[model samples]
Target: MRRCPGGRSWRRAAWRLRCFRFVKIDCYSIETNIQIFAVCASVARRCGYPNRPDRGGGPMNFSARGLSAMFSVLRQRNFAIYTSGSTVSLIGTWMQRVTVGWLCWELTGSGAWLGLLAFADMFPSVIVGPLAGAAADRWDRLRIARISQMLGLLQATFLFVALVAGFLTIELLFAVVLFHGVVEAFNQPSRLALIHSLVGRERLGAAVAINSIAFNLARFVGPAIAGVLIATVGVAWAFALNAMTFGAFALALAAVSLVRDDALAPRSGFLREIVDGFAYSVRHPGIGPILMLMIAAGVGGRAVVELLPGFAADVFGAGPIGLAALTSSVAVGAILGGFVVGVRQSYTGLTRTVIVSVFGIALAVAAFTVTDTLYLGAAALAVAGFFMVTTGVGSQTLVQLAVDGSMRGRVLSLHGLIFRGGPALGALLMGVSSEFAGLRLPVAVGAAILAICAFFALTRVNAIADALENEPRN
Candidate 1:
C-alpha cells in the first residue's frame, strides 16, 4: 500500500468511502485504493491547470492588429490637445518672428543688426540651457512649461503695448527679444522633456515625429499669414495675436491629464547636477555624436531662417509676401519630411537618412543663393526645408532612443541648447559676414560649410549605421 501525504490521505479516504458504497472492497486494501484515488485526482488537477509566467518573459501578446487597436484607443484625444494647441501657438510665434525680423530690417536697414537681434533672442538658450536641463530633470515639467508659456505671453503683450504707445524703439525691441529668448531658453527644455510623459515609451518616436509635423505645418502657414497680416493689419496685430495664442496653449495644457512618475533621480545642487548631466552625456557614445551633429547643423545650416527678411528685401525685391513665401517654403518641405517619417514603421538606417538630408539642404541653400527669381528662390527654400526637417527629426529620434529614463530631461535640455543656441551663433556669424560681404555671400558660405559637414558625416555613415543597428532593445 502506498502512503499518501497527510492532507492528501484524508481526501483519499473520503473518496474511497464513496467508492465503497457502490462496490465491495477489502479493509486491508482500503489504504492502497485511497492512495491510488488521490494520485489520480492530483494528476487530473495538474493536467487541467498551469501557472502563468511573469510579465517580462515569454513572447509579447501584441499582434499588428492588437497594436493598432491599442494606439487608436490611446492617441485620439491626447493627440488633438497637443497637436492643436501647438499648431495655434506656433503659428502665432512664427508670425511674431517674421514681423520682428521685418521690423528690425525697417529700423537699422543693416543685415548685421538683423543677425544680432536674432542672436540675442536665441543665444540665451546656450548660456542657460544646462541649468534649465537640470531643472527640467528635477522639477515638474508641465508646471515649468506652463510657467514659460505665461512668461512668453507677458513678453508678447509688453511688445504689443510698447508698439501701440509709440514708444517702440529698436533698442526696446532688442531688449524685449532678449527677455523672450531667456524665457524660451527655459521653455524649450521643459517642453521637450514633457513630451515623453504625454505618450509612453513605445509611442515616443511617433509622438516626436507628429510634433515635428505640427510645428512644420505651422511654420508653413504662420509666416505666410504673418506676411499678409503684417502688410495689412500692421506688426502690432501680430504681437497681439501672438499673445492670445499663448493663452490658448496655456488653456490646453491646463486641460490635459498628466501622470507623474516618481522614479527619476532626486534633484541635486544646480551646479552639481549640471556637471553630472554633462559628464553623462559626454560619456555616452551614441548621444555624444548626435549632439555634435545637431550643433554642426544648427551653426552651419539653420541661420538661413534668420536671413529671410534680408533675402526678401534685398535679393527678391518683394515685400512681406516674399518673406512669408520664403519661410513657408522651408516649412512646407519640413512638413513633407515629417510626414514621411511618421508613416515609416522602422527607424533602421536613420543615420544615413540624416546625412542625406544635410547634403540636400546645403545644395538647396546654395541654389537659393544663386537664384534671382522669387519663384525659384521659394522652390529652393522649400527643398531646404524638406532636408532640414528630415535631418532635425532623425537626429532627435536618435538622441531620444539612446538616453535612459533618468537622463531624458537633462539630456534633452542639452539638445535644445545646441538646437537653439547653434542657430544664434550662426546668425551672429552670418550677420557679421552680411555686413561686409553682402547677404548672398553669407548664405553661400553657410551652404558651402553645410556641404562640407554633410560630406564628412556621410563618410562616417557606416559606423553610425552599425551603432544604430546595435542599439539596446527597449
Candidate 2:
C-alpha cells in the first residue's frame, strides 16, 4: 500500500509539470500572435486606415474594417437625410438662381450687374468663412447648423413675400441673395467641419465624396426641376418653394442624433483665430498647396457656373429649359466624378488625377465657348462637370488627409474661403470682361488661364505626391 501511494504521487507530479509547460507555451503563442497583429495593424493604420483595434486592452479601438463599417452606417443615415433635404432645397435654390438671373437681365440687361449680384452673394463667404470656422471649432456645430438653416429659411421667406407682393426688384433680389450668402458663409464651414465629427477621420474622404454626391445629385435634380417650375408656375412660387424647402432641412437637422467630440479648443477672439489660422495654413506645406490650387481653380475654372445664365440666354437662345439641361449635364458629370473618388481607398494618385482633370476642364470650357448647339453645349458642360468634381473632390481629399485633428476646422475654413472667394473674384473679373469685350472673351480667357494653372500644377505634381507619401500614418 505504501509503494502504491508513492507511485501515485510521482505520477501526479509529472502530469502537473507537463501541464504547466503546455500552458506556458500556449500563453507565449498568444502573446506573439498579438504582437505580430499590432505591428501589421500599425502599418495599415499609418497608410490611412486609423481605425484598427489593438490587442489586449486599449482605449483606441480602430480597425480599417471597423472604420469602413462605421462609414457605411453614417453614409446610410447622413446621406439619406442630407441628400433628401438638399435635393428638395437645391431645386428651389436653382429655380431662384435662374429667376434672379433672368430678372437681372430683364431689369438691367447687363452681364455686369448679374456678375455684381453673384459677387455680392459669394464675396461674404471669403470674408466671413474664417470667423465662422472659428465658431464651428468652438461651438456645437449641429446647433450652429440648425440656427443657420433657420436664418436661411427666414431669408427665403422674406424673398418670397417680396416677390408675391410685387416689391421684388433687382436690388431687392441682390440684397436678399447677399443676406443668404452671409448666412451660408457661416453655415458651410460649420456643416463641413461637422462632417468629421459625424463619421470620424477614418472615413472622411468617403464622407466628403458622399456629401459631394448629395450636392451633385441635387445639382442633377435641381436645374431640371427649376426649369420646369419656372416655365409653369412663374418665379414667385419658386421663391416660396425655396422657403419651404429650407424649413424641411431645419426640421431634419432637429431630428438627427449626432455624436460630437468635446475636445476642441475654447473659442478665442475672431480676428486672432482668423489670423492664426491663416498663418498656420501658410506654413503647412500640404495644406498650402491645396489651398493655392483651389484658389486657381475657383478663380479660373469654377466661374463657369456664373456664366451659365448668359450662355443659356445669349448663346443658346433656348430659355429656362435649356439652361436647366446645361446645369444638369454638369451635375451628372460631377456625380460620376464623386463616385470615382469615393470608392478609392487612398489619395495616393490624387495629384496626377487633379492635374489631368484640370486640363480636361480647360479643354471643355474652350470647346463650349465655340459651340452654339444646345446638345453640344450640354456635352461640353458634362465634360466640364466631370473635371470640376474631380478637381474639387481630389483637393478636398488631399487636404483632409494631410491635416491633423487640431487644425482641421481652421484649415477647412481656409478651404471654404478659397472655395467661396475664388468664384466671387472669378465672376467679377469675367463679368467685367464680358461687359467690356464679349462673352467669348471671358470663356476663352478663363480656359487659357486654367490651362496654364494646370500646367503649373503638373510641374509640381512630384512635390505634392511626395508630401502625400510622407504624411504620418495613423
Candidate 3:
C-alpha cells in the first residue's frame, strides 16, 4: 500500500505476479484479495491494459474500445475470420519453434546447432520464396496456403511422434526443419498475396498491418507459452498443439471464397520473370540499397534472435521459460517498435528511422553481449528486438514508397528474401562463430559491423526519400 513512483512496469508486474502465486492456497482470504487488488491496480496504473481512469477516479473498461481501434479493418467478415484464426495458429507455430530450439540445445548443447536450427527453419524462405511468389500468381493463394499449412501439420506430427517415441536425432530434426522451411517458403508468399483477395485496396494497408501485428504478437506470446509447457509437459505436446492449431487456419481458409483475376496474372515465363525481378531490385538506386541494407541488418542484427535459446540454457541457466522471456523480449521490443512507427506516422522521418534502428540494435546487442546477468541480457535483447523490427519495417516501408507499380511483386518478393534469407545465412555464420569464439564475441562483432553499415547507408538518405517521393505505383 506504499506509493512507489520509481517502480518500473516490469518490476511492478513481477511483484504483483509473485503475490498472485499464493492466491490458490487461500482463495477467499484477505491476502488473496490483496494480491488480486495489487495485480489489477498495477496493471491499470502501469501496464497499458486498455483501461482509463474515469472523471470520478474509477477505471473504465476500455479493452474492447482499444482492440476495435487497433484493428478497425477486422470489421470485414473475411479479414476477421482469417486474422483471428491465423493469430491462434501462429501462436502454436511459435511454440513449436521455440521448443525446437530448446530441444536442439538440450540434445546438442551447441551454439552452432542453435544457429543451424534457425538456418534450417528460415533459410528455405530465402531460397524458394521468390519462385513461390511467382507461382502464387498462377495458383489460388488460399489453396496454396491451405496445402502448405497441411504440410506444416504433417511436419509437426512427425516431430511430436518422434520425440514421444524417444527416437529423435539431430539429423532428423534438421530434416524436419528443412521440409517445414520449404512449406513456409510457399506459405509466406501465398499468405501475403491472399490479403488482396480479402480486402479491397482502400483497406489493404490496415489488413496487411494487422496481419503483421498478429505474427509479431505470436512471436512474444508463443515463446512464453512454450517455456511453460516445456517446463511442465515436455516438448512433444508443444508439437502436437502446433499441429492441432493448423486445423483452425485450414478451416478459416476453406470458409473464405475469392474471385481470381486471370488477366492480372503474370504473362511472362518464370525464368524471365525471375531474371526481371532480379534486375528491378538492383537497377533502382533506392530499392537496391534498401535491400542491401536489409541483408546487412538481417545478418548482423536480426539473426541474433536465433542465438536466444543458447542464451537461455548457457547464459541464463533456465529452461523454456527463460528462452521464452529471451525470445519474447525481442518480440516485445518489436511490438513496441510497431507502435512507435504507427504513432509517429511520418514518411520523411522513416528513412532516418531505418538507420537509427539499426544503430539501436547494435547498442542493444553490445549491451546483451557484455552483460554478466540474465536480467540485463534480457533487457538488452528486448531493446535489440525493438530495433530489429524498426529496421525491418522501416526498410520495407521505404521500399514501398520508392518502388515501381509494375515491379511490385518482384520487389516485395526480394524484400522477403533479403530479410529472411540474409538472417538464415547470418545465423549460420554467427552460429559457427559462436562455436569457436563463444556467443559474446561473434554477436558483438556482428553488431559492430551492422552499426558501420547502418551509418554508411546514411549517406543515401536523401536519395531513398526522394525516390519515395517520385515512386510509381499500380
Candidate 3 per-residue lDDT, tens place, 1-474, comes to 112224589977765564454333223222332333333334224322222222111122235564455467677788888888899899989998888888898889998888888898888877788887677655667788889878888989999999888899999999999898878876776676566567654444445556666777899778867765665457888899899888888888888776432224556887777677778789887788778888888888888888888877777775556677667766766666554443332354556666766777777888888975765666677677666766776676566556554455556777777767877888899889887887888888888999999888887777775665356454
Best by lDDT: 1
Across 28-50, the per-residue lDDT of candidate 2 in tens digits comes to 43344334334333422342322
Q: Per-residue error at 287 for model 2, in Å? A: 1.1
Residue 66 shift from truth in candidate 3, angstroms = 10
TM-scores for every predicted model: 0.83, 0.82, 0.83
Tens-digit per-residue lDDT, 159-260, candidate 1 = 999988879999999999999999999888778866667776566666777789789888867876676556545788889999999999988888776654
Instruction: Rank the candidate models, highest lDDT first.
Output: 1, 2, 3
lDDT of each: 0.74, 0.71, 0.70
* lDDT at position 375, candidate 2: 69
Once superposed on the true structure, which residue ranges of model 2 sit more than 4 Å away at CA? 1-83, 266-268, 472-474
